[model samples]
Every structure is written in C-alpha cells, then in structure tokens.
Target: MKFQKPDFNPRIMPPKLKVLTLEVEKFDNNFAGVCYKNGRRYVIDGAIPGDVVKAAAVESFNNITYCGLLAVVKPSEKRVRPKCRYYDSCGGCDFMAVGLKDELAFKTDYVRRRLFPFGTEVRDAATEKGFRNKITLAFEKTNGKLNVGFIDDKTKKVTDVSECLMHEAVFSDLVKALRFWIEDNDVSIYVPRFGTGTLRFAVARYLDGQLLLTVVGTKSLPSTEDLYKKLKKRFPKVGLFENVNAEKTNEAVVGDVKHLYGEKFIESEMLGIKFRLGPDSFFQTNAAVCGKIYEDALEIVRGKNPSVVYDMYSGIGITSALFSRVAKKVVSVEIVKKAARAQKELLSENGISNVEVIEGDTEEALKNVAVEKGGVFFVDPPRRGLSGATEEILRFEPKAVLYLSCNPDTLVKDVEKFVAAGYKAVSATPYNMFRATTHVEIMVLLEKIENDE
Candidate 1:
C-alpha cells in the first residue's frame, strides 16, 4: 500500500460559511479535530477535545477540509490564554492557548484511545517534559528590511517572531543580531520576484545545552567569518554555521553548509552515550529534557532486552544508540545521506559497532529489511505520521513497537491501523518539546498479539 496523493483542492470550499455547532474530538498534526456536521467531516482549527464551538467551513486542500472557529459554545478545562502577544498572529505556537498540563493529558489520552482495541486494560501514563533537541527558524527580508519569524497558517504571511517561550532566552538576542547584521551590511534582500539576494533563513538547534545556528541565504555571505566571530564572542555556547540555498524557490533548506565557527559540528550526550551533529542533521531542539525521553524509552525496552531493534526514521541514530546498550543489535534507517554519514561516523568514532545506519526512506527501506521475530521496532517519523504502506509493513508483527511522535492525531490514526493488525498499545509518555506551542511529543509502547492466541 503506497502513499497516495490527495486529490481534493483546499480552495474548493466556500470562502465564508454559516457558523455551526462543531465538536472537536482530538488533535491531528498541526490541525485540530475532525468536526462532524450533517454527515460531513470538516477538519477544524482552534477547537480541542471536549470543546463545542460554532465553526465556519473554510478551505479544502489535498483531501483535508478546514474550518475556523467562529465562537466557542463550550470550552475544555485545558483552554487558556496564550502567553505570547504574537501567539495569535504567529502560527508557530498553536497549543499555547491551551494549558500545558492539560495538553500533555490530551496527548496521553490520544495514545490510550488508540490502544483501546488491544485489550480492556487501559491506564493513564505519566508524561515527561523539557526534552527538545531541535528547532528551525526562517529568515525573511522584505523591502531591504530583515525579519525572522514563522509563516501564518491562514494567510501564509511572515510575521516577525522574537520571543518564543519554547526557544531559549539567548535566541532572542541572536535574532536581533542577525537582523542588525543584514541592516548594517546593506545586503540586498532576496525577493521572490528577483530570485537572488542575501540571507534567507536562520535555523538553530540546541543539544545538551549547546546551540548550533545555521544561517541560510541565496548567495555567498561576505561577513560569514566576521559574523561567526562576533556571535562566538557574544555567546560562546552557540556554534555558528553558514549555508547557501542558491535555488530559486521558497524552500528554506540550504544546498551547501559551510563551517564558519566551531569545529564543523557539535556533540551532545544522552544517557552516557555521545552523538555528533552536523549543520543539517536532524535532532530535537530542547536540550535540557531529552534525558527523560531516553529514560522512558529505555524503560519500555527493559524486559525485551538482548533483542535486535529496528529504528525507523532514526535521525542521526541517536535513539538507535540509546536502544543499542540493552538490545543485542540496532539497525537505524535515515533517509538523508548526510545524516546517515554523520550517524556512521559518530557511531564508529564512539566505538559503537552494534548499530548499522542505513540511508534510505524508511517505508522503502523496510520493504527489503528482514524483520526477525521478537525484535523491537521503534519509529520516530515526521509530523505527517506513518504512511499506509509503512503501516502495512507492521504486518510482520514485531514483538513490540515503540512509536515516538510529535503529532498526536496522526499517532491516533496510526494506532488504529496497528490495532487493526492485532497489536496492543501498552503505555505512553508525553514529552514537552515545544513548551509554548500546541505541539507535543509522545513515546508509545505497543505489544504484538500472537495469531494463535
């Protein structure tokens, strides 16, 4: 079962619709609940579970129907006022309007709800916090003025974002410095109309309290060395890297990464295990709390030790090594070649020989890999969740499946597929990666049911 492209266009729906009583059932990726109305399902925003609201049907795109909240008829106990003034304007933080503790509870419930089909034994699991190891920020320059912010969900407009609670306090100053540098250098801003210019994006990730900033632009930076030097002097904790996009597109990723500061890359530790990260390597952003994630994940694999483990969507193979200590062997698959190289180098440098880093798409790679019976499987995929074909691969029925996700709604849907395949979700733990946003990360453990039983 390959992942099919959605056929529906999002702009086909009415521009404005009459408000109707819409009930939000659960969080799905960046969107809210799947609203039920008059035998039609409208994917709604700003409505949480247990909340009844008057919503206006809006756009439909790529098989997803969207609705906006017109009025809240009934609110959930989790609802709260967003702390940041930019929360409503900036689309980066959605769940900021909801209580932090309740958000965790909602994410936890979503996991338990998916496991309901496996057995009657359902329990509320404890969640962890403060463990984010990766974060990305876009750099936008309009009319020779530089701005660092996120894209608006509704209008797709870039709003300058400075103070995100989820980001470290030091990042605020970095944004200011980058803006000042652009202004000082009189560098031409990259315009979609012109298709060439200077700085375009600034992405930074924190691991083990160390920060790595990657500045992306359309052309070579003139003051890359100076900027790195100044930033290193200002904040010695941050390692700087410069990158060029060069491509004439809206994509934020860079084509080439240049080491401007530090030692070309940075290293972080988790549970006595060390891992090296390059400029573009995918890792979590919140540095202080990922230890809890490693601990909780290790607990899930406790009784199942001395087994081979397959780590799908394993970014840089950090989690792969986390499981390698207890497991007999760990094979981690990453789609990006650069990340796979980094994983291989890091593992080899650390003298870790039990793990194999395969570079290929997880769904495509899993098609060829042999899944030995009783081997533990861990998948930490992107927010889009598991593809239908990827779910079908679970038909091999590994002993236990530990799913780590940043989106709860997709987790629920994937859980449905797993339940259908006769697997039971045993426990889950939510970890707060984006503190001020609606996004949450969860680690779920599921056990496979024997066919004869």
Candidate 2:
C-alpha cells in the first residue's frame, strides 16, 4: 500500500539546510510528520501531528526535505506512550506512538485525500493487540553472533523484539526459542556479500489457535531435527518446516519447502467459513479488516444478485467462496499454476461446487467461460493494478464491478478506465487493515451506465 509523500512542488528544488524547529502538520504514509518552512516541506521521522520537534536535515530533493527527529520540544496531544518497548527501535509498526483513535482518524482522512469525488468512507478497524496472524523475522550476524529480528526499513539494521503483541501470544515465547536454538547450535547466518550461511529468515503464521513456522536457510541445516523437537514441545499443534532459499540474492523468499512435523494444512476460518491454508498460501495478515472487505462485498452481491460472478485474479479463492453463496455460478481466473489448484482445493474443502476454477490469465480464460452478459466482476489485484486486464474485464459488460485495491493510485487509475468504458463510479470505501500503520485497503464499486443507443 502506498502512503502519501511530502506535498512538494516539482519545479522548486530545495538545497540542504541545518537544524531547525518545526511544528509538524500531519503524517505521511511512513508515520513521519510533514511540516512546511520557507515554502519548503521537511519530512521528519518519528514526528507526529501537532508536534513541535527539533529536526536536522539529512537530505533535500525537489522542495521536499528529509530530516531526523532529534528531540520533541513539545509532544502532540495525539501522542501516547507506545505499548511495545521496541516501538521506538523496531521497524514493525508505523503508528505506535500515536493513539489508536487518532491513528484511525488519520487513516480515514487519508482515504478521502486519495479517493476524492467517489463519496469514500473508511471502515475504521478496532484492531489493536493480536491483530496480525503472520510475522517474518530476519536472521543476521553481528560480530560473529547470531542476531534475529526485524530489519529497519531506513537503516537496514536488524533488531530483535522481546515481545511481539501483533500475532498470537505464543510468538513472544517462540522468538526466544529461535534465539536459543540458532545461537546454541552455532548456526551460520547468511551474508549476502560473502554468500556463505544457513539461517536467513524465520516465518511464523497463526490462525485461530494453530501456528505454523518455517525456518528459512540457504541450505538445509543438519540441526533441523533438534529445532523440530523444540517447536513440537512448545507449540504442539504447530506445523514445523524448513525452507531452502539457495539463491545468491539477499531476498528471504523461499524456494523449496519441506514439512518436518505436525499438520500440513492448517484449518482457518473467515466470516464463519473454514478454509485450509498451506505454508505458502497468500492471505491477508489482518483478518478483522479482511472481514470488513468481505462483508461489504457480500452486501454488494445482495444488491446486485447477478446470475454469474467473475472473480478475476482470485488468489486462493477465499472471495470466490463467498461469491459462490450468492451467485448461481462463480468463475475464478487465476494465473499461477500452484495457486490455481489451491483455489480449487479451497473451494472443495468448503463443499463449494458452484465455483469453476480457470487456471490461466484473465484475458484468455474469459474467452472460454460462458458468462451471462449480466454477470458482475470482483477483483482484488496486486499493487500494479489491472495492467492489461481492465479492458478485457470491461468487455463482459458486467452489471457492476467491485474492486479491492491495496494501492490507491492504481485503484484510481483502473477506476478511471472503467468510467471511460461506460461505468459510473458508485462508492469507494477504504479499510484500515493494519493497526498502527498508514497502509490502507480500498474497495470501490462501479455500475454499468445504460444510455439510449
């Protein structure tokens, strides 16, 4: 999800400057505060709305200045004591310093600024603690000692947190276990420059009560059997696995996964429907906010009651499962080979027979599927919205199109194209999925506009 940057003028390039006192006006997407001084915008990290902060300029570009917050001369009323001890140091959360109420309000206004003239409304989430169901920790070596933690977005430094209140309560204990296991076993930490190490990353996912963990390394560890025993002792129901990512790149993405212990697919639920999720399954970390999006889509389905529903870019088929209940038949077009089968299995697990899974690109699959001219489209695309699929989807002449987007800019870009293709904008509602963060999940509705031909 894209955050608002410093509102800067492109033609006016500002030069580097020294330290100064600035009253922060508002927050950008990164939870940094923005303030204008002498017709220039300064973005100070860790500053908040209504704050009087002392800042030193790090760099300046085009009218926008990046600064570091030295001290808070006067704290804003919006500021509150952060719950996480590592909130000041850890790079996990974006808005931990601000109160939850104010954070939600800021996010609501942010959606308005992005999706103007669509009558947008933000469904503020009440999620604060235990909101996330997933966590990824980076493994680094500092001075020949194993360090496991989250990597800071700016400095690229990794710092471990004693407690992570985002996921299940057991995560805090789980991290300690990882530290002891990696350090005691003398595990080799992956170094990108030298390209010789084992431990690269640790990924944990929790659903309801079941937890799944995958310890990633450049190559399989000989001591993995010991790690599996430790996990089974702590989290009995935990699915233990080791992922091999032998690629020379520094990215933590897994290449091959091997299940070591426990359940392969954890049974998870969303809106009362149970679904099975594997280790590599893509799901929204914030479950409560995802429910809000699904509920709103259900409401739209109730209003339209179309005969056929086309779920374009359906990942894992969760939305398709929901659509199958309301529509007579649901056609899902998914591109990834593995994802296509996963969608079919997900629907089958829930006893859903109405959804026909088409394993191919949206444009090609649409040609073979028989659709009612009155069918509606449901799309929750990746950041690079629609790309070339928007025109193909509009060709169906669906009665309505409900789009869920994480990137506001792409959402607007795709919506504009739909409007040009004889669709009228109905409403755009943004959902705050992540707590204490500026990230937004938006859902926009468009209806076909009929005219005298």
Which candidate leads the pack in TM-score?
2
* Separate clash counts for every candidate: 13, 0
lDDT of each: 0.70, 0.79
Name the runs in model 1 displaced over 4 angstroms: 1-44, 48-67, 70-78, 114-135, 140-145, 193-196, 361-372, 383-397, 407-422, 451-453
Which lDDT tens digits does candidate 2 get at residues 1-453? 322334322123255547789999987655579999899988987789899998777667788888777779999998888888777667678688877778778877776666666544545433424378888888777787666778866556687666776666777778887887877798888877788877888888888777888888877876877776777777767888888888876566656678887778778788766777787778888877777778789889778998899998888888899998899999998987778898888887789999988899887788787657888899988899988888788778899999988898798889888888888777777676777767777788889989989
lDDT, model 1: 0.70
| 10 residues in a row with least lDDT, candidate 1 | 2-11
- Each prediction's TM-score against the native? 0.79, 0.91
For residue 105, model 1's alpha carbon misses the true position, in angstroms, by 2.5
